[model samples]
Target: MTKPAEAQALPDPSGGDHKGHRERLRRRFRDAPGALPDYELLEMLLGIAIPQRDVKPLAKALIRRFGSFADVVTAEVEDLRAVDGIGDVAATALKVVREAAIRLARAPILNTVVISNWDTLLDYCRTAMATLPMEQFRLLFLDRKNALIADEVQQTGTVDHTPLYPREVVRRALALHASAVIMVHNHPSGDPKPSKADIDMTRVVRDALAAVDIQLYDHVVVGRKGHASFKAMGLL
Candidate 1:
């Protein structure tokens, strides 16, 4: 009697059969989550989206293409699909995970005094904006107690610059009944240092807000390198 076709197949170079390997990965994740490196963690994630196949090579390809686990998830879907085994389903899975993480980070700061939870707010900002491909100007509107009232992306621009209208910012603040606001934008160039243009635009917004008696709390610039706070640097 001939052996079953699956039994005749050669072992996967990564290890045993695909199903067995996937179970081992899950067991490792459940037993000691931190033990798995980026590639292994990503391997497991990809398995969920592409069952019936060994995903180790695909996972490593993603890491090599994007440089890290975070970068892979934050990558544009079309870019993700360009990888060898990543399809619409796999790319969407990665994006879903990224969105879940951003929402998790953002939950703590909603309706809370943001300055009191400063670190969490920074974390939320980085998760939302750090990996974006272009510049995005965002506003955090605050009530009298400094509790966050709204978070809005005011404009999105090219890889290097965003045109921000000070009058429009103030108009939105007044309409929202916001007592104060935090300005935020990202640098795709990975340096959070404020450009001369960034500083001048910030000053223009500050003055416009002042006319409406709405305080400008800070202007934070975020990037892959880190974040810079205008208030902390005495630029505000």
Candidate 2:
């Protein structure tokens, strides 16, 4: 007697398959490197952490929770874990991406004259501080040749404000023998518009640095979307 042939089940064409979806995304990225939407880029990243799993929903959920793909990368570890399906390894992977980006942005500024590299300076600043949950006031001290001397975070405060002292800012510059200084701070509210306090603080810091004969080059306010430069606005 001839054995009956076992019936083969076909994949449902209307339903999506993880392998096919991921391969399609990978092929799309390879074909046009810059064309994938932010969610797809994030999906590819998540796929690395989650093996053989459908990561598209997790990727979209992360973006929806954090408000953007960049925010998802830059989110705090606990915050990342709070999202469903994101475990320790996945959260750490996202943080690794954030650090890599910041390091890449910072590479050009090292041992280089910063005044001539304004764009790179801004890029580094944005990568480091733009997505922070709270306010941070950081200082960039420069040498006589305008090379970066040191970068320091002087204060961290609430979402709306960071405490800063002009005397301390100059004192550190003098201690570092920095000839010029650039002040940088981030607003958690995603608006780089400087408040009145920002203007007054810049003036005070400028005067204090002047007393020490150190130049105050600019005060920059950074936010998630953009940055504001005091010198560019004629406020310096």
Candidate 3:
């Protein structure tokens, strides 16, 4: 009689048995998502972009380098790519997550009376501007009822300075038929405190808007550390 053929071992489909760990993570997330630490959540996110390998170490490394899960997702694509295991695909994935978060934060304030939702407005502004690597000046145009008409970036400049033209701001406000405006900008240095220049610029913009009967609601400066509001400080 011929000897029975030996059975061959099949290859594992979960990329070296990582599927079990991933499944456990999924179950954990499903059961109690809030219980999972930032690194665990980040590991799961990275796993979706990078398959066929253990990604726990990579996730931990990213959290370490970026300081937190929020920082990791908000980091620039080029900066994300600088990490050892991150490629274009992974960087794009992170950016997509960031965009989703920003849009979600922004949704509640749109077409709503901004002063009534001041905290939400600040949350949205911080989500959109806090992580930027350069200065970006934005205008929040408001209708007669103080509802948001449009949110537009007026200028982007180097890490510290962005040129602002009061005339351009007035022009945009008039074009949008906005009766009020809120200014916003970011400080890459992670300090939300406005410099003398910021105060002077806000004064100029306020005077110009007043000329056209447009109210200056506030000038908000966002940074990684926190945010500041001109109105809150009695500067507006």
Steric overlap count per candidate: 0, 0, 0
| TM-score for each model | 0.89, 0.84, 0.87
Off by over 4 Å in 1: 1-16
lDDT ranking of the models: 1, 3, 2
Where does candidate 3 stray beyond 4 Å? 1-15
lDDT of 3 by residue, 1-236 (tens): 43212111223344677878999999999999999999999988878877666778878999999988888997777788777778776778788988899899989999899889999999999998898878999999999899998999999998899999999999999999999999999998999999999999999999999999999989999998999999999998
Candidate with more favorable, higher TM-score: 2 or 3: 3
Strongest candidate by TM-score:
1
Output the lDDT of residue 68, model 2: 82
Weakest 10 consecutive residues, lDDT, candidate 2?
A: 2-11
lDDT of candidates 1 onward, in order: 0.90, 0.87, 0.88
The alpha-carbon deviation from the true structure for residue 95 of candidate 3, after best TM-score superposition, in angstroms, is: 0.6
lDDT of 2 by residue, 1-236 (tens): 43212101222343647878889899999999789888899999888877557788778998899888788887778888777678777787889999899889989998899999999999899999999888999999999999997988999998898999987898799899999999999998999999999999899899999988999999999997799999999998
Q: What is the lDDT of residue 55 in candidate 2?
A: 80
